[model samples]
Target: MSDYEISNVDPNQELAEQGSDNFWLIAAIGLGLTTIGIGIKDFFTSRKLKQEREKNKLYQEVLKKHQAQINELKNEKERREYRDRLWAENSN
Candidate 1:
């Protein structure tokens, strides 16, 4: 029997196994964080878009009501102007 004979076990194999396990653990943690970050970003973005759409709808309704009032006022002004013109012509 010699000092370095008949041993098939490798110390490097244990190191390789440990390295592989660490690599897998790091990969899983990275994937989990990426998924969580995307979910949070999407939730906030969706909420902000919904709020903006609601605000725009309210503004559109206000604009429609204001336009209707302006049209009515314009019609009244035109009627008054026509009456004034007829009165002036009759006087002349």
Candidate 2:
């Protein structure tokens, strides 16, 4: 004698109603998965770009240091050649 008791519901109608609601549930899950996929892809791509920029900066720094060392060696060689020339002239 409960007031909340349902007595004559058709099983086929209940199944059909459930099937209709399931469409929205499936659609929402699909959209969520696609969003996550795109987010992951973007994260990796941005990380790779950042790493490449850092590597390029390091390479440029190393190149600058190497050039400075080469210039110092050139200056030393020129000085040594000038000293040798003066010594030969003074000996004569």
Q: Assess candidate 1 and give its lDDT.
A: 0.97
What lDDT tens digits, residue by residue, belong to model 1 across residues 54-92? 999999999999999999999999999999999999999
Q: Which tens-of-lDDT digit does each residue in 15-74 have in candidate 2? A: 898998999899999999999999999999999999999999999999999999999999
Candidate 2, position 57, lDDT:
100
Which residue pairs collide, candidate 1? none
TM-score for candidate 1, please give it. 0.82
What are the Cα lDDT values of the candidates?
0.97, 0.95
Cα error of candidate 2 at position 55, Å: 2.0
TM-score against native, each model: 0.82, 0.62
Candidate 2 segments exceeding 4 Å error: 1-31
